[model samples]
Target: MASVHWAIQPVLALFVASSVLLTGAVERSPPSFVVDLDKPAYERWNSVIDANPDLGRDAPEIFKILTGNINMSNDTWGILFLMAEKIHKRLPAPFKEELQGMADRAKMPISLITLINLAYDLTAHCTSVVSTDANGTIWHGRNLDYNATTYLEKYTVHVDFKRGGKVAYSGVTFAGFAGMLTAIKPHAFTFSSNERDVGSFLENLLEMMDPNSKFLMVLIREVLEEAKNFREAISKFSLARMPAAIYVILGGLSNNEGVVLTRNRTHVIHEFAINMQSDRWYVLQTNHDPWLGDPWYDNRREAGETAMNRTGRNNITVDSLYDVLSVPKTRNKYTVYSTVMSASHPEAIRTWIRNSTELIPPPPVRASASNVVGRFGTFAAVLIVLSRNL
Candidate 1:
C-alpha cells in the first residue's frame, strides 16, 4: 500500500506538472512536426513516434472504453482487436500505413492502434464556426470535443505535410491518427470536420465497410494537400464520397470564403455561406444540419450562436472568437482543444489544448463515454498499469 501510494503521488504530480508546462499550449503550440509526403505513409510518423514514445501506450484502456457495438459486453481486448482486424481491411491506405508505422515504432500492437484510430469514426462530435468580421476578414474557430478528452489531449500534434521541401498543408491532429480533423493550408483555406450520426449504427458500419467511400477526415487531408484554394477544396469536398455522413465548416482566405456543408455518404446536401450584404456573416455548426434544430439536451448550437451574435461581426477577433467558443456548451468538459485560424492570416492559425469542461449537459450514449466519468476512469486505469510495472 505504501509503495502504491508512492507510485500514484508522482504520477499525479507528473500529470499536474505537464498541464502547467503546457499552459496556453495553443499559443506556443503543441510539438509541431513536418511530415514528408514522399515517404510511405507508415514511415512518415516514425519520428513522431520516436519523439513521443507514449504513442499507442494508452490504446489498451482506450480500446476497453471503446467497446464498439460488437463488443460492449466483452471485457476481453483480444476479441476487440480481432474485430478491428476486419475493420482494418476497410480503412484507407494512408491510415493503414501510418498506423502500421506508429505501432512498430511505439512497440505497440498494430491491431490496437487500428482500433484507436477507428474510435473517432465510430463516435465523434464537435462545434465549429466561420465568421466574416465587419472588416470582411474571415475567421474560423472550432472546439473539438470527444469522449477521451483527457488522454487524447496528451497526444495532440500539429503537423505540416510537405513535399519537395515545401509545406503543402497542415493539421492539428492527434499523434497516432493520420487524418486531419482540424487543418489549414496557409494562404489558401482552413476547415474542420464533424461526425454525423443520423442513422442506425449498423447502417454506419456498412458505410465504413464500403470500398467506394472515403473517411471524411482523410479526404480533408487530401484536399488540403492537393486543392490549391477555397474554390477547389469546395468542389472536391462536395463531390467526394464518404463511408458515413459528416459536417464540414470551411474558412477561405477571402471575406466571402466562409461556408458550412452538410454531407451524406456520397455528397453534400446543403451549403450555408457568409452573406455580408445580407447581414448573415457568420455560421455556427454543432453536429447538426443547419435546417434542423439540435437534439434535446444539446445546447451547443444555441449557446454558440448566442455568443457569436453577442460578440457581433464588428468584433470577431481571435480572442473574441475564443470567448465565443468558451461560452458554456460550446466549450465543454469533453473538448480536447480549441482552434482559431484564418487562411488569410496563415501565421495566426493557432490551436490550444483545452482543459476546461464546464457546463456539459447530459451527453447521449457514445463511443466516448462522457468525459465527466471517463476522465477518472482513464486516470485510474493508467495508475493501475503504472503500479503493476513499478
Candidate 2:
C-alpha cells in the first residue's frame, strides 16, 4: 500500500505540472502589437525632484509637527506626518536624520511622525483651497464634499498650512472646478490641471515677496515640470476617442524592511478602472512610481499599518494610487509605466456621467418600403410643381 501511494503521488505531481504547463502554453500567445516606448519623461521628472533639495525644504517643518510637536494641532500634525512618510526614503540621510531629530524632540516615533508629515504635505502642497459650508463640513478645493465625520473623503488632495494668521487646514474640493474640469476635459496640461492658472496666481502673489529670493521661481519651475510630465503621460496612454481622463498622483513611501512591495506603483491602475466601472464611470487611472525597483512601497505599507494601529485611523488605503493605475492579474504579462483612469473616484464619477444628458441622438434607420413610398410621393409632387414652374 505504501509503495502504491508513493507511486501515485509522483504521478499526481506529474499531472499537476503538466496541467500548469498546458495552461501557460495556452495563455502565452504573443500580443498582436506592443507599445514599447521607453517612458523617460516620468523618470526625468522623478530625478528632478530627487536632486532638488529646495523643492522639499518645507517638508521638515511638517516632520517636526508629526513627531509629537504638541504646539501644532492634530490636523496640522496629521498632514505633515503623511507627507514625510511618503517622501522620507527619497530624502538624503542627513535630511532624514534632521527630520527624525525633530520627531524625537517632539517625542513621537519616526513612523508616526512621518505619517502625519505626509498627511500635512498632501494637504498643504496638493490642496488648492478649503472652505467650510453652513453645515460645518469641510470642502477641499478639488470639489470633494464630505461630512464632518469623513474628513479624508472630502478632497482628492489634502493640504494643511498656516494661513490667515493661524494654522489652517484645507483640501482641494473634489466636487468643484478642479474635479469637474478633470472629469470632463482632456488631461493635456503640464504640472497640474490647475498649475498654469495657479502658477500665474502664485506669481502675482510672489511679486509681494522679495524678488531677490529665487525660491519662488525654483518652486514654480519644479511644479511646472511635474505637471508637464503628468499631462504628457496621460495623453500618451489614454484610450483614443474615449471620453476617459487620467490623473497622476505622485507620492512616496519608505522601505526600511528592504522589500519591493509595488512595481512602478502601477498596481492600482486596473483597480481604479474596476472601481470606476463599479461606480459607473468608464474612466481610466494611471500611476507612475519613479522608485519602482525600490523597496519603499512595502516598507511604507508595513510602517503605515503599524503606525495606523497606534494612531486612530491608518490614513493609507488598501487601494493606493499605484493599485488603481495598474492591473495586478496581468502584472507579469504587461508592464504599465503609466495608468489611466476615467475618474479619480469612480463611484462619484459614474454618478456624474450617468446623470449628465446624452450629447448626440442615436443613429436613424433606413425607411421601410411603406415609409419610403410615402416620402417618394411627397417628393414626386414637389418635383412636378418645380418642373411646371421651370
Predictions in order: lDDT = 0.72, 0.25
Candidate of highest lDDT: 1
Candidate 2 lDDT, 187-269, residue by residue in tens:
21211221111122112222212222222112222332233333333433222221111233221111110011111111213
Off by over 4 Å in 1: 1-28, 64-80, 86-93, 200-202, 357-390
Candidate with best TM-score: 1
Clashes of 1: 5
Q: Per-residue lDDT of 1-390 in model 1, one digit per residue for the tens?
A: 001122323433333344435443232357899899999887899877877776556766655544332224233354445555666665667777787788888888777777677666656689999998877788999989877666677778889889999878888887777677888888889988887867643356446655677766567777986889989989999998877788878899767788998888888899999877788889889888888878888989998898777667876777677667766578776888888888888777777777643233334445434533555354345434433332
Candidate 1's C-alpha lDDT? 0.72
Candidate 1, position 247, lDDT:
86
* TM-score of model 1 (CA atoms): 0.80
